[model samples]
Each structure stands twice: as C-alpha cells, then as structure tokens.
Target: MKKLICSLLIALPLTTHASSTLRCDSGLISLQDSTSIVSSKCGEPISREFVGYREVQDEYGFYNEVAVEEWAYGPRNGMFQFLRFEGNRLIKIDSKRGR
Candidate 1:
C-alpha cells in the first residue's frame, strides 16, 4: 500500500504535465508565428485569457512592456493545448491530458 501511494505521488505530476500538441493544416506551425497567423490557420481558440503585461529586456538593454495571453484549445477527445503568446507572437504551446 505504501509503495502504491508513493508511486501515485510520483506519477501525478507527470500525468498533469502532459499537454496536447498543436497540429496545423500543414503539419505543426512554426515558432514565432504571429497570433493573427495562428488564428487564421487554427481558427479561434476555444478559450482566451489575458495574462496581463510583462517587462522584458531587449538586446540593447532596453525594457519594454509586452502583453501576454494564454489561449486554450479543445480537448476534442484528446489533449487540451494551451498557447502562450507574448505581444502578437506565439511563445510556447503546452498540452494537458483530458479528463
């Protein structure tokens, strides 16, 4: 029983960390694609969230405020994908296992 519990504890995070992958009409979309481009290709996400602004340093040691947003797509009998965008560019895509 203790082993089962320990195993479950160790596995919980791994399961939760699973995320859905993005599949575009022409295979996977390229990184740094603009949000508008993604929207055109993948259509609007199921859900959209504005995470607010963040300050980032540029190459010239200048700081700029960028808008951050998290867009969630459907589980669709599969994994749910979350797209993170900074300003208008896609920064990352995360997938989570569906229920």
Candidate 2:
C-alpha cells in the first residue's frame, strides 16, 4: 500500500504536465498542432484573446516575433480548457474548474 501511494504521488506531476493534449468531438488536438487543425477539431472555441507576441529563434539563428493567443473552450463537465498558441502552433493546454 505504501509503495502504491508513493508511486501515485510521483506520477501526479507527470499527468499534470501532460495536459498538452485535448480530445475534441472530431479528433484529438495536441501540442504543435496548427491553429486551423485545432479549430477544425474543436469546432471553434468560446473565446479567443490576443495575448501578445513572443520572440522565437529559429535554427538559422534568426529571431522573429510570433503572435501569442489564448483560446478558451468550456464548461464541458464544468471544466474550461484554455489553449495557448504561439506563431500558429498550439503550445500548451490548460484546464480549470469553472464556477
């Protein structure tokens, strides 16, 4: 029992960090998916906000400004999923319980 509890505790953070994927009605959306792909699978988010711009460096050692945005889709099971995008790719997925 103790070993099981310890294993579960160690695995908790890994699950939390693996929130980079979301299941939609059509398909699954994951990190690095394009904005168009996410929108198509998720069928449009409830809200989209322009977060700002991030400077990203490429393999060529050139830095460019990429648009950053957050798209929210929710109240599904009383939880909201927020997707963060940089440049045109989905970078992160977060979920929170709604009030």
Candidate 3:
C-alpha cells in the first residue's frame, strides 16, 4: 500500500503537466485569446482544419456544444505546431516532435 501511494504521488505531477495549458511566444498566445488575435499575431498557418461541433464540459461542470478547429504552422523545414481552437478561443497547442 505504501509503495502504491508513493508511486501515485510521483505520477500525479506528470499527469498534471500533461494536461497543462500551452502558451507561445512568452505569453503572446494564451488560452483566452481569440482566433483573430492568433491570425494577426502568428500570421496564416500552413494548414487549417474545421472540426465542427463537439460536446464539451465547461469549467462550471455544464455540458455545452462548441465548434472546434485546428491550425498547423511550420516554417519551411522547421518544427510544426498544431493549435486547437474551440468557439474562436484558443484551447490547446501541440508540437510535432522529431521534426
């Protein structure tokens, strides 16, 4: 039981960091920023995707519907990033590794 508890405590931080919100450009990109802001600041992405309606749970624990979108950016031969947007709000950013 003690070993299990210790292992869980050690793993907790990894899970927390895994789901942590992502930021870009020293805080230029944040969770609450709108898609328009991202476009103007980050310029046009290399690829864009419309994910359509998705059922989501809000901070208040209420289920709601939201429109999801994804944008990908890459600079020539550099790393590529994937940004997810929900209802015009930037929600998540994922970087492609081993690029």
Candidate 4:
C-alpha cells in the first residue's frame, strides 16, 4: 500500500503537466515577433522574412528570463517563434505554423 501511494504521488505532477500542454497552432502568432511566439510552443523556425533576433536573460533563483528569435521552415510546415521575456524570465509563449 505504501508503494502504491508513493507511486501515485510521484505520478500526479507528471500527469498534470502532460494534460496542461496545449498543442502547436493553438495560440497567438505574429510575424513581427516570431521568436516569442515559437518559443512558447516549442517551435523551431527554419526561415523568416526578418532573418533573426538576439535574446538575453538574467538569472533569478528558481526562475529565468530568456529571449530567442528564430524561424523554421519545413517541406509543408514552415513556422515562426518569437520569444518573450519577463524581467529576464520567459513566462509566456505563442506560435504560428504554415499549413
């Protein structure tokens, strides 16, 4: 019984995380700020109309601020990601996909 309870406790967070992940192409996306958009959705852009952007971050205990600007291109699924920063920590994300 103890083992079963321990397993459940460990698995609870994982289950919650898995359920919380929303799919790509399900959020706000902008060509002007592709870096913030894709980073939020785990998007890896291959190409961009604006080339690229630079990102910087400052470390805070148990948190971080990150910035990324990248574009991705696929045979049938090109995309853009615009990374946004919060005091040095990236806390929000959005993405746009080519269909």
- Whole-model lDDT values for every prediction: 0.70, 0.79, 0.65, 0.37
Could you report the Cα RMSD, in angstroms, for every candidate shown? 8.5, 10.2, 11.7, 15.6
Highest-scoring model, lDDT:
2
| Winner on TM-score (1 vs 4) | 1
Per-residue lDDT for 5-26 in model 1, tens only? Answer: 3433443334544323468654
Q: For residue 13, what is the lDDT in candidate 3?
A: 32
What overall lDDT, based on C-alpha atoms, would model 4 receive against the true structure?
0.37
> Distance (Å) between predicted and true CA of 23, model 4?
13
| Tens-place lDDT digits, model 4, residues 1-99 | 345434333433322111112345547443343345545654554433232344434354344333342233232334323234333334333334433
TM-score, every prediction: 0.73, 0.79, 0.62, 0.24
Give the higher-lDDT candidate: 1 or 2.
Answer: 2
Candidate 3, residue 54: Cα displacement in angstroms equals: 1.1
Task: Quote the positional error of residue 27 for candidate 1 in Å.
Answer: 4.8
- lDDT by residue for model 3 (63-99), tens: 9999999876653344455678998998887654322
Best by TM-score: 2
Q: State how far residue 52 of model 1 sits from its true place (Å).
A: 0.5
- Residue-level lDDT tens digits of model 2 in 1-99: 345434434433332323878999899999999999999999978777787999999999999999999887766886667789999999899876644
Error of 2 at 69 (Å): 0.7
lDDT of 3: 0.65
| Model 2 CA lDDT for position 82 | 71
